[model samples]
Target: MANSSTNSTPGSSAREDAIRFYQIAAQRQPTPAETAAYKFIDPLAGFANCELKIFEKNSDLGGTWFENRYPGCACDIPIHNYQFTWAPYPHFPSFYTGAQDIYKYLKEVAEQHNLRKYIRLSHKIIGAKWIEERQKWQVQIVQTDGRELVVSDGETKDGEQGEPFIEECDIFINSSGAYNNWRWPTIPNREAYRGNMMHSASWPDVDYVTGRTVTLIGNGSSGIQILPAILDQADKIYVMLRSKTWVTPALANRFAGENGANKIYTDDEKENWSKDPEGYYAYRKEIENELNARFRLYLKDSQAQQMGKEATKKQMTARLSAKPELVNDLIPDFPVGCRRPTPGSGFLEALCSPKVEIIWGEIDTFNETGLKTASGKQVDSDTIICATGFNMGFVPRFSIVGLNGCDLREVWTQELPTAYLSVTVDKMPNYFVMMGPQSPLGHGSITGSIEMLTKYIRKLVSKLQTEAYASLVPREAATKAWLAHALKWMEKTVWVENCASSFKNGSSGRTVVSLHPGSRLHFFDLLEQPRYEDYEWTSLSSDPLSMFAWLADGFTAAESSAAADLSYYLVDAPHLKQRSRCAEEPTRATATGN
Candidate 1:
């Protein structure tokens, strides 16, 4: 019942601001005379309604948490830190809850908020093109029952019957996350394997992995967690590693169990959290402060980072003592935070088991039964489980064509996929993104920051809705300046160290492409207000004088409203304005999502 308040500073709450301007478009159309009245100004005059649509590829919600059901699939970030800042849940069973639990929690959220009405599950956006004449995006989408998609201008890649239909929108928001589309390892004769093969993302039942000899690839986040999870069940496991990586405890490990493993909550603890709002808020703030402060660990050669590395090494070395040689093969030479850190609970212990074997070097080829190593060593297994991760090279699952026939995919492919504040591109007008390249996800919690970014997006959309503006896109010079500044700041961080990372082009590249250079709080501050000066816009009215079209009538709708408070600005007002609620019908929308 508690934990509803967010942004309890001096003035209005961020949550209240978000609720007030929730996706509404201009209500009134201003006449030519009103628009041309340049001297007259109005902050809010013609603002009304807007429609929001969500296209989900899967049958259910929960993007990664629903898809990745691997043996030890759980959030590396604790549940408290991962939850929405505005809508914190009092009852999370564990600090690192499983995928199922996470999915169920999301499902409950959708139902409670009536979000499914705006969402079209089993729907996927195939392509998007900016129509200059209309100042809108013509988007193509299709309903799929989880079939293979082939988006093309001519024909389907498989010649399937699923033809995409088109829908036009004033704005297009892409939430197609980096890890949505997966790719197999580029091992020669990968398809020739007759043995059972499965990806960590597209995992089947745990029964399928039981009693089978498994050959695992990639020791990243997924690989790290899967080892100990299936160690006791599988007959034998051969972990294939291309390079070494550090396995460190999770952020805010003091709030978690030993070595930052999952900490289960007791019934009494849940009851206390549900009742004591201040106590729960204090606890949550303490955890978040720790999470934000740990950004210092990424500062190259800093005292905090050095101490962190040594502490992590001590923990990892002790755990790998049973097989001391793993210290050389498993630990990385580069500093911590070079690669994404995950607390691989019992992973080092699993390596000590006789049934588990660690193989060095990449898979040169895959045989009919298993893998053929670069040294011509034949590694046999009953099943090959490739945890070799997603195609996170910034390639889109669907095509996106921006202004002047500029293909966004080509731009990203040819040059670095940069953005304006990691939100929108140069030519992609009327476009916004949730989690894009160089986002605040490095030191920040992924899902938690998404909520913040959505508020920023909401603020931008409100301008287009209330103000009589056709569209606005980031300026080319502004984007370039932002990118250059980001790159410069990144050099001071540990991410620039020589390490094999998905963030870079490959093992040797020093450029960090995936994370924001600044801290989470810095990103939040940067996005607290929209910078309209750095953008190029076209007014809704094409007339040259219509540039001031937002000043129509020099009046605000609030002045006419019966429930509005005229003296709202006065400090310590005796009474606050109270507005009547909408009827049940319009308050709850059941329109079919396009």
Candidate 2:
């Protein structure tokens, strides 16, 4: 049962990873339990395989990076860690890069992988239902030119939207990330303001901010970044914050700029990385290691947490010394990492500027001209920007009906979002999710986890394709066990503290839903291989022998072809010599955090 695929390179790309996983799997035999299940041997027939397709609501791909085009809309994560390992771009403009720069890089990766042709742009998934008879998903799609806007009032207008259509697939993967569903502020009478009002998610042109008095609300990640980006363009600005948040310093490497300073790497420095590949790898790993060691700061009342809080306060106070009143007004008493802190490079400097006005209070109401505060003060402005973020719950905005017509939106939203390892649903067969509930994407560099999860998903799909499985679904008991483990582990993390973070369910939610309750590396370890025993499966074939269908005709597709690498295993025979398991994956020492 050797794999027909000749792809030997692992961790290079998704397709290659799948091939490697299957190749490794082919050399092994099934466990005793996998061979003993009764319902698994029940009467079932074969299923059909369909062609692959991808759809994007936008005219282009880039998902959130394309959607959030606001001023100062740059990623807080360092550019080194922000990019994919498979597709490396040596020439990064700055440490904290802009959104468009990322968008372009992502597009380049897509085109390099020749994925653009498979993706159907300007098309969105509005509804999905499980068709049991067909053993597939019937997905409803809406094709658009990508100009429609869902305003604050939850209405779509002033843009063209095409009629709905249907498409079927053997498996469905939801790639719509957590932050894509941007929401407006829930303040009463939000529609009263007739000025150039915009949400941070739906940013207009920079020209819209020029020569105007701008007011920014909600000092989240976007708010902190937008203040500095608009300071030069706007004549004056008034910022309002409903609660306090911590702003972190830079991930200062030796070859970089000051904290909050976006360092544009010199051409010479960028070229040197290209020439010295090892040096660049070390540099990237250094930053990753530094971040990796910082997990101890999240522990409640730990020495690192205490020290980090004091250090962050000192940095913020010193930076905002020009306007000392802000120190007491903005600094939160909660733990430093209670919410995910952004690397707010220019935020403190912008607030210290004379042209800016900081107001810490709830918005009473919005007038035709400007906004009014609950403190009996009025701030008149030409433009009002609601840097209000999105609902971070992993629930889909569209309709999704699973087995027994179980509604995904209702199950996730009405109750709690219960996902098996944040990849598959409890009852939804053949459906997979990326960046779903209990995901570990909140830590360190997301690209690393993304790559690991890519391999994870691809491996599962490979099993389904090669094995005789019609559908796979997580058992409800397994989901409960996973969720219980998550909650118990989360008790010691900073994310469960009192804070109004997007990580939680809502303003009053204490349960952290946005991320996994473990170190980023630990999460990667869990997803290293798919756990077949954790899920329930229905084979597409009736005969028990069909499970070994991969043993097709006593010969592989590779053996039939000329110019095949028959001696490939022996070609790397020297490297294939025996190695200890501990040598392959070393055990962690319980000595220190750093």
Clashes of each: 5, 2
Candidate 2 residues 1-594, lDDT tens each? Answer: 233222222222212111212111000001111111111121131112324466666667676677788888987877887776655677888888899888888777666756555567666667888888777888887666665332211134223376888887777777666666677787777788888899899987557688888999888889988999889999999988778889876754343476556789899989999999888989888878887877778889889899889988988898888989888988998898888777787898899999988887888889888888899788888888988888777777677899999989888878778688888898788887766788875676666776566567656766666554677898889999999888888889788888988778446467876678788888889998788899898776555645544443445546655988776666454545444544675456623433
Model 1 weakest lDDT span, ten residues long:
25-34
Q: For each candidate, give its TM-score against the true structure.
A: 0.86, 0.85
Flag regions of model 2 displaced more than 4 Å. 2-50, 146-160, 252-256, 543-594
Model 2 has an lDDT value of 0.71
Q: Kindly report which residue stretches of model 1 are placed more than 4 angstroms away from their true locations once superposed.
A: 1-48, 146-161, 505-507, 573-594
Q: Local distance difference test, per candidate? A: 0.71, 0.71
Give the candidate number with the greatest TM-score. 1
**Compared with the true structure, what per-residue lDDT tens digits does model 1 show for residues 69-103?**
88888878877877655456778898888878877
TM-score of 1: 0.86
Where does candidate 1 clash, by residue pair? Answer: 25-48, 25-49, 26-48, 27-47, 27-48
